[model samples]
Target chain A: MKTIKQISVFSENRPGKLEKVTKVLADNGINIRAITIASSEKFGVIKFLVDRTQAALDLLKQQGFTVAQNEIMAIEISDEPGGLHRLADLLARKKVNIENASGFVIEASKKAVILVEAADIEQAKSELQNEGLRFLSEEEIIQ
Target chain B: MFWDKKIETISRSGLERLQLKRLKSTLAGINKNVPFYKDKLKKLKIKPDKIRNLEEIRNLPFTTREDLRANYPYGLLAVSLDHVVRLHTSSGTTGKPKAILFSRKDIEQAADLIARCLVMTGMKKNEVFQNMMSYGMFTGGLVMHYGAEKVGLLVIPAGPGNTDRQISLMQDFKSNAIHITPSFALYLADVLEKKGVDPRKDLFLKRAYMGAEPYTEATRNKIEAIYGIDVYNSYGLSEMNGPGVAFECPEKNGMHIWEDNFLVELVDPKTNGPVPEGKEGELVLTTLCREAMPIIRYRTGDLTSIIPGKCRCGRTHRRVSRMTGRTDDMFIVRGVNIFPQQIERVLMAIQGVGRNYQITLDSLDDMTVKVEIRKELFDGKVDHLVNLQNTITEKLRDEIMVRPRVELLEPGALPPSEGKAKRVLDNRTL
Candidate 1:
């Protein structure tokens, strides 16, 4: 079963400040898989899914970066429109609630991987697979 | 020649040495023209050139924000208003808005300084830069916009708001950089996500230069990770030239001040004496480049320090640490100096009180403090609002010497902040 590791990297909203956070992950050879920023002009909350989830979390936390570990869903869907909607609808049908969803495409003409914080990960994955939705591997996201 | 001098090379040292000269000239000018300074300086028996170095400079009476208010519109300007090319005024906590003046040179210098800061953070020439800082009246937008333009970068004058247009420009023109407050940047990111567009992959943003309010390290990482770019810290005051006094270099550790253009002083906020290097003190600035209104030992009220060193980025000019806090931020809650941040720290510690909070002084009454906490109260299941409030009030009373009337507001009801969230409202009529 593939899983998504939501790695939180603490940073200030000033320039070159982000370099410190990304540098830690890059320095430790942890590859960033998917990233999306929830930020205001003054501050931001950066969420990342990396290759070595536990290592990245430990390193960032030890470095005094307030990193939190949360489980996110690694959902695979067809590369066409409404693919996301169908997968979400399937999860809803199974009563699997998505708290937040974000992801990136592997490449052109392939499935798009999404990282979702759902109420129930096992139920979500089971429902999606039952609905014929393809789940992506953690290796593919890091690649 | 100015560019060769590390102090003059977009860094802050050149500005500081230059401030000495400006401080002298401005003091002399003020003594000759401005009635208040003329009286004060003469009474203190301080002559123009004699007021040299830090010790002598301290003897000179400091300029305060209250002084600016007392002076009102024109009294603060050292040069005539005709020489003043523009004006930016924000309503202070006082009845009348505090006003600041800038000459053509002053504006150009500020813009040029900002331009250097832009390039320092990897802003390429002709890159389509979108300035989301508020335009007009607010100095943030125009100063940076001109600065980017001065550096020959393509500018998108997408002021503030108008989310659709900003998105369309990002999609169409492919903007490379943006200058906005951190909150607005997050908001734009949200809009981009809502539009089903990934900002990192689609947009060409290489930088998000943000400042105006203090933000946590968490915010910085979030902005950079989402946008996939560098975020630079820029610090300045409307009293001084806005947005270009000091800026963070590519090294990302601390901010370098353009010391040649502005004499930067770090004084014990209370004593008005120089604080030790690297020590936090009220940042008082002397503008060496302003033709319209050159301020001398003008207390910025904003707290920071003179880093005093050569930066790894090879800039010899001195740098200042990120603005830690402000001096006048102190609130006399029941006759004790209480910084809202102290209260905020306590409030954030409690799960019941959400982020947004307001502390107001009841004027018509006995000048009692009423704290309105707007939070995600329902999220906490401990029936803890009253207990949490009581705990906070007790902590505040112990720390700040005052009891607060804690009124809890529903989540998202307090005024949503686009810039620095105003945390306090002094309802007391002075």
Candidate 2:
């Protein structure tokens, strides 16, 4: 398993705010490998796994967006009916709390990568490793 | 202890009699000396002789800021330029500034009135007074300076800004009294706390005169708690010879208007007529004793109300409540008249809201407001933030009669203003 820097940006929950943030990252040639939005009534936190994490964070911060970085483990699991459940069950057994998480299939019908944000990411990783799980590296995700 | 006991404590009938005498003379003087007033009166078919009593003031037309700007430099001066000893001007945001002239006698009277307010606030000759307002054409600085000198106080003419020097002066010289605006006073309170100087012990600040802007009672309480001093509200304008027009006495209930100098009226701004007694409306004032530039029936554009009773301080002059906001500052959003003070009241009542906020009106297809929330409220809980926004939105709709978009910003994200806090930003061209 590999821990990647997941950048979370706080923005106004209004039209064009998301577009504005994405446009700034896109203009700077930052590729979004995986993205998920957790929104409330007034604001939204957009979590991103990008090809250039530091560049994306710096650019968004320069544009006056509140940005933060968190370490999360990205795992590649079998693209089966119980893929997410299996990962959740392992984390729960070890008393690891999942703060947030998102996943997508890179190779359809075979394998999928789920980005898991846990309270103690290292503990989550060690436990997952003890259970014989495989993680997608930064090189693999960018490619 | 009364500066002008005979005048200040006169009976209401006696005061009105004196006011009528001064009003008649002022009316005749302006009609004979100033062409603008002469023309305005002639067009309205009004004559100085027609004013039988003080109540006849209603027959005269109101003088607005537009009228003053149209005249520009010396259009409203009743006396010649050589006799005009000093001049002050309004900051004309939309057009030309209105120039106010003061004769030597007018300056002395103004100083005397300011000294009367000072004495009412317990300013003594033994105490050192520090003036912390801008000393240029703005009337707040020099007006208080002249009054402090008149009252025989050792006045330190410390102009505004430079908080370090101000704190040092207060510490070194044991300055017991100060004159400052409410906003600057709040900022200075923070600086003083950070410098580790306890205002109650390390410093000798006893009384403060706050004016030049409208502030809430909560803000006054905050400043008082920070400085451990008595804060008095001083109200005036350049057109009315500055900071002596009215003042709060020991009671601190309402500011007493100097009826001998200013004839005050509360009128419905839209209809230009009187409102019910003690009802809030636009303040309309007429200078009774001014010689150089006697503005008759001048509309101040400030919203306040006459207290309708005598102050407990034994001053016979009628008092007016603290000003809430300006008529010109009111903006119409979604066909609803909204005052910034209404929104401020709502925001201040809510917990976790910061002292600073900005209301921006944007016009894309329809007019919408964007309210910036403080950063401290963002505790990283997305659900809590959403609930807070929705609560504010619902409360704003209930309070201001309009729903606005809320955006939570980092602390100190909004731009800081130099002088007054720019509260509203209307980007709508229409």
Candidate 3:
């Protein structure tokens, strides 16, 4: 099973929190490949697919930021109307519940990748692979 | 092991006899020297000598904080200024602070009571004592210092804050005991963790005297676990010669109030009548030994109850439960009485909740509790964090009877712990 590390940082929902988080990453020269922020009224968790996962995690932690490295699968699909629908249908058939997801287009109208966080990552990965779906490796996602 | 073995283990009848004698003298002293009490007693036509039994104390007019404030700055002095060697004021957060004066004898008596408290807690001679409470007008520092010295312990008089210096002093001097607030103790635990210093291995601290603030038993357990030391609860107010009013014996069940020095009463806050036996109520105290300021039936505004049974230590003095909260500290939310300590009790018992929490009541009478989540507990899962929030909300609702909005914050988001933590922020207009 192939998986990529997604760095998630806990932040209080207040001004300058994002700036502080981004500043740490920018100073350490960690390039963010993809980003998603899920927030409630009082706080938020900022998840990032970064080029250098370990360095980013270490830098954020050293800067006193609460961070965690999560294993998630990123799968590419054709950038069309049925791109996400087909992936969702397949995961639904396999009973893989996506706990969290975020995506970005690699090429306009050509291809895109969806970051999938499921309850059981290894099971989800094997189930998806048995369905002939390929997951982007860490190097592939970073590139 | 006892400072005054005869006094500490006196029979109930003997203790009552001594208390009655001292009570009579205190009344006479105040009647002659303090015009305020003299006028009050004259209005009631109650003569000091006619008061034969302790139950007659109920006839005495209560001295309230307002009364103390009204008689501030020597208005209630039972002795002349020439005899008053010291003065300390209560931390008056509401209005004017109450002024408390002490003659040389009063100071010595206060120190003697403190010595009794310290020795009861198993503090010994030649032990290094680090005093971390503030000095100056705050009686917690100096009174405990004098008492520790009386016990022949080497007093450090460190006087709060300067955590780095405190740790170094503990390590270098091999201090065996300390006097500190519970909030500061939690902050010190954090500092020890950050410095990679194990208290059990790196320092020689044996016990901590935690007082000057009301803390939950859960907080005490947490501090005890972190420091690997016994945390004894001490109760006092500046109005009553702080930090020596009541102290826990080694059994740690409840604090024994020195009956020879104080007459204790537990009265309902609403009716000002005595609560049923062993029931919680406002603590009313009468000083039997204070020379410069002998307060009669002083309503302490602190809420506690008398433990029904005698302690295992066999002290004739009765024991009082830990202070649940002050009368003024209780807030009515949705017509239900709730204390900030209840919220703290719930929060401290949870696994991942941090030390600092604040309860904010808005004008709408709605409550919002802001809790700091431990940094290590943040596992990057929003669901886990949400579950924690729900757990806190449910536990708090179960404890307080009113559901509160619980906000999970990152560690260090709230104000840093310092001297006497303010846990409640009431914004209600009423």
Candidate 4:
């Protein structure tokens, strides 16, 4: 089953918006699976999924910041400069435009987060898998 | 305008005689007054006797835009600055305006040619001529003011932008003629209609002479429909003479070139050779009678054809077609050749956006120039702002071949100019 993961991103309301979110994931045992933020004029909704979403949400909620969990993707990508190119090329052949993406690669555990939106999410997943691309599930990044 | 030019467009036979005489005089003037020309003539071993007619006048070196720009301010003035009474210049976008100095006699002669053009466009002796072009330092207003007065017509130097008051003057004075740009005229007519004032019914306006910028046929129709007046196209430049180069007769087919006042040539801008008749080329002018700062073969950069067929007006003065467009103004925007006319056409077609947009080039972090369009607003509504911006951005991207960030602004927000309508706002070059 193709499952979308949700990771909790605890970001400071001030100077370090994205930096705070990245620092929280690096300190914890949880890996930032995938994330996206929907922002309004002022406050923003940081939506993401971690390997240990339940634990990350609990820890971030304890920090007293408005923490929320939302569905995203943590597709397992090869730790190469253009590994995403191979993944993106497959999606592009299926006519999918990546609006955002995020996650950590297992090869070097190079924890990176991205937010993406595509025209057809179902087609993008299927085409990537059929092209022998591996995807990190919600359970993979946390440990 | 040529009293100082001493150019009174004479008949062909008379022109031959005048050409021979001016040829001798010009050669003598060059030899005596101008050391550069004298040195050039000496280097060529050509004397005054060697130059006989207009053909030999061609043997002289052609002056270019570079020459004009280099010798700007008072450098090109043949006469002393104290003798020069009047001054005017164009708003050169690239650099400083080409300051033109006219002597007292130069002003009167220019006024005379403009007056003749006013009559050609059917201005009566006693009718009021409202000069709506910009006044002070710009030739459009001053030339029309002096020209109408010389022809025994009452003059109203109202200039432009005061639409409500100008309309009142037209109605109260029973003004018969108005001289302004076609774009402003259309804007005025639209204003009149919205204010529940019909120009033809609510006021008295007989004709309008429009120039200073090129416009389309559709614009002409709109202006005519709103004002219920004949709008004649007039062509001129500060370099050659202001406001009386050529004018369309009632037929509106083409403007009759005043052969007596000036000599016109259709030169291929690229090849610099004479273009065949009926073919469009850059209109090169030679003022037959300019004494102070006399310009020779000055290129207008306006694309047009010298149509040689006889007109029904029966003057036998050769006619030039109203300027079609320009070859110089074409610019490459993201590898797409964009003309202001194209953007204006699309803008006029769209009803929502006002006629006050400014295109700006902004630098992005990617080391590329991006176009940022500040959309002029018709009404102050946020909903409409988003919609119009989106629509215009899409349309402009499709037509102009580059994507632009469109931001809708409240009406009356763009910068205003007291002299010329500040339509083009380019900050990238700076």
Off by over 4 Å in 3: none
Candidate 2 residue-wise lDDT at B113:
96
* lDDT per residue as tens, model 1, B257-348: 77667666788876667898878898887777777776778888777777766777776567888776666566665566667666665555
Docking quality band of candidate 4, CAPRI definitions: incorrect
Q: Candidate 2's residue-wise lDDT over A13-52, tens digit each?
A: 6778789889998898889888888876556778888999
Q: Which TM-score value belongs to model 1?
A: 0.64
The DockQ score of candidate 2 comes to: 0.21
List the global CA lDDT of all models.
0.70, 0.81, 0.89, 0.65
Contacts from the true interface found in each model, as a fraction, amount to 0.00, 0.27, 0.61, 0.00
Per-residue lDDT of B1-430 in model 2, one digit per residue for the tens? 6767788889999999899999999989999999999988899898887788888898887888998998888888898889988888888458788888889999899999998999888888888999998897888888889988999999999988888899999989999988988767866765665567788789888988988877777777767877889999989988888887989998999999999899988899888879876899999999999999998888998899988776778999999998888888888877888787777777666665555667888763333434455443443345556676677778888997778777665434566432456778888887
Q: Which ten residues in a row have the lowest lDDT in candidate 1 chain A?
A: A36-45
Residues A98-125, model 1: lDDT tens digits: 6557866665567777677765667776
Q: What fraction of the genuine interface contacts, i.e. the true contacts, does candidate 1 reproduce?
A: 0.00
* Ten-residue region with minimum lDDT total, candidate 3 chain B: B410-419
Interface RMSD (one decimal) of model 3:
1.0
Q: Across residues A19-138, which tens digit of lDDT does each residue of candidate 4 receive? A: 666666678866764455643322244666566667777776554344544434455665667767766776667776654455454557453323334435576666555666445454
Chain B TM-score, all predictions listed: 0.80, 0.92, 0.98, 0.81
What does DockQ come to for candidate 4?
A: 0.02
Query: Which tens-of-lDDT digit does each residue in B271-388 have in candidate 3?
Result: 8888875899999999998988889898998999899877789887999999999878888888889988899899998988998898899955589999989988777778888889
